[model samples]
Target: MSKDFTYTINSIFFDENYRPSDGTRITTNFANLARGESRRENLRNALRMIDSRFNALANWDNIKRDRYSVELEIISVDIDIEGNGQHFPSIEMLKTNIIDHKAHKRIEGIVGNNFSSYVRDYDFSVLLLDHNKDLGAFSVPDGFGDLHGKLFKDFIASDSYQEKFNKSPVICLSVSDNKTYYRSENYHPVLGVEYLPNESSLTEQYFKKMGFEVRYFMPPNSVAPLAFYFFGDLLSDYTNIELIGTISTMETFQKIYRPEIYNANAVAGNHYRPDLKHPDYSLTQIVYDREERSQLAIKQGKFAEEYFIKPYRSVLEHWSENSAL
Candidate 1:
């Protein structure tokens, strides 16, 4: 093996001009939405489905309490790869921007005025691990921490991100663990984890040194936890607080509507049994994992409630009441 090959992976999200880049074409939902003359209408319908699913997770029937609604935005993040000896360590984020749309209002402390989202290439993360079998768990080479730090620092300091949002954005990601993790107390499924780079976590330590706050949240009913990083006071932002709910809902939705893209095995496409020669050859499961996904949504929603919503209940209530006016 040459030990050197390079390639670019596009984000699943849309770009500034509201176009799906070359990379987004692999996914079924985005492609279907981009098809035909009714893209906007299709998008609206999809949003409605997502919103409805989110609301279902809320305790709306409670007469004494108020409810919160989440706003969703699709943005682009392009990663250009210049393959070096270790490709994952050399990948660089080139551009990132939110799609142009009427619904996208520049919320203070949420999205920047330049309308950009986070930029980093994690698509090849698994491939990197698989390729570097020689290195095994110690595959993350030197300078990886520096690269990670610079990417986040640049994103936080970027004109696109800093123009509107005064603080950092919340970062949600899957946990980096080979073993299946679960909540010790209840034995229920969790999808997130709070990662502190103490002696236990080198990745967390790298991010902590770079001024990033890391937490992991696993979806409800999931066998393991994913990592979520908070860059600023995301727990206090009413609108942004809906982020947890939004992400959990959309991911569950994908599993149902687009099983081919679902991270079913938690390794991203492992369950699909893709044949490299036949790029489109996916041995997708005939039955959707609706039960697991629904349970995940419920658990994820509750997790958000305790971690984000409940802590700031009074603030959220006040915002809800005021926004009604």
Candidate 2:
């Protein structure tokens, strides 16, 4: 895919009146900047944190504390799903373009995990929270995320995408604490042990339809494992700096979104497990209400169902029936 594959905000493509909920991906600091705040201090501070973190880790050359300069651009991408052969509104994305000093070029490109849906409110929150659902024997439909899967496939395969990006997009996700991932010998220098889950989760299955495979890697000196979705050799496809760019960015988000697990003040080790009820030490700089985030996801799912899903229920059902693999 040597074309300009620009990743548009698919979250808002399905709805015209869609507004980014307070709990969506992208830093809350950026959201404040979008709300007519003329001062750029907050945005500056957030960006500073990224650069600082990256500099502390980019110890390729000891003489230079900051070997690489990092900058983030919130690019707006408008991707059209050619499955419908039509146009939808452009989506807003807080895209992170990780640049390295040695390379002096863009190393890794990724969108933060929130505002995370190509279709306004995605199942990221609602369905994923099922990891905690105490309900016994509850079942999700086989076709549950087929629509998103199909739409995301077209989103990546679209002409606009091929023209805007040079490589397949990378998605960063978390390893569920409820599950245990056995460490494997296949490991890279930057990304530590490769952990394999007992089985694929529903989240992994649906993501596969969007042309992504899963990798469980906990970076060296990191506390826990993370679930990364992509289409190529995560270990060999990119340079160490490129991999670190993503690792640093995603870990920053996880530390903010899930401090209880990812952010503990202790010696980093692979066998570590977070005691959610009480961590040895977990501090949160930002206010991220997981409960509220999940609740809003339920609300958005209903909105999508009423506005987009039900109205085209028959068409969707037919698509699902014929497109099953």
Candidate 3:
């Protein structure tokens, strides 16, 4: 068997108003606001629709043994107009709105008590707030390092986070702007052992000892360019099996999916290897694991377009057959 590689998977969520030029909410016919429905109720119904779509696409039978699963954490927030002097409500306000009001609490409870609860069955979940200049006003309570840490410690630390996930996983959230959104070069560096010096090699050794095949991809260029090339090579190698990874835009996906047609490689820019001349240093190279790759593939827009759409198409085809019976 060929040596197995490790895949680092990441995902981001954009609200209805995600465009770069202006902060505006896009209207959708799918709005859940029915007569007499509270805003929270409407939000919950919309969330349920999203959850159903995600769950339908992530059916257990479709999960391959070689693939690792990671669920995209759903981020919930109201659209705020840019240049509004009003201090947008803090994360605390958001939480309070969900937890304090009886009706909102009930709506949240139905969705799952917290972010972790909402995604407990999967490996991990993250709740992200869109990046805005006024975000700092949404302060973290004292004694916590930052908003991210506080939310993780408080919400995820509850019983829900401790519950046994189908797989052991890590979760986190971030605020991003337009510049950081589309470019793989701007993607946050992989954390844990992957970034630690001499750690990649050690992790590979550990995995090898555990009876897993491991192959590291240590390109002589920067991580972003390497990532781009790696994905290209990966898709070519696994044409039979679907390949996945995250990108900022559908255009970006189209470019990578068919580089020959789009000339995305030209836009891919330069290759940069980490500046570690010393051989026996702290940083080490780790390969992409199959399971992680599978999850990454889905999150990165691969499965979203291909694997996910197929089941829905099939179900639509069979709907009349079942309904007539």
TM-score of 1: 0.45
**The 10-residue segment with the lowest total lDDT in model 1:** 112-121
Best by lDDT: 2
* Backbone clash pairs in model 3 (N, Cα, C under 3 Å; residues 3+ apart or in different chains), count: 20
Question: Which regions in candidate 1 have their CA more than 4 angstroms from the true location?
Answer: 1-19, 22-49, 61-71, 77-138, 184-211, 218-226, 232-241, 248-250, 253-325
Candidate 3 residue-wise lDDT, 154-265, digit = tens: 3323343344222112111111111111222222222101111222332233223222232222111112222121211332332111111121111122222222322222
Decoy 2 TM-score against native? 0.75
User: Mind giving the per-residue lDDT tens digits that candidate 2 earns over 115-146?
Assistant: 25534354544543453487566566545666
TM-score of each: 0.45, 0.75, 0.21
lDDT score of residue 28 within candidate 2? 34
Judging by TM-score against the true structure, name the best candidate: 2
The Cα RMSD in angstroms, rounded to one decimal, for candidate 1 relative to the true structure is 16.7
- Name the lDDT of candidate 3: 0.23
lDDT-better candidate, 2 vs 3? 2
Sort by TM-score, best first: what order? 2, 1, 3
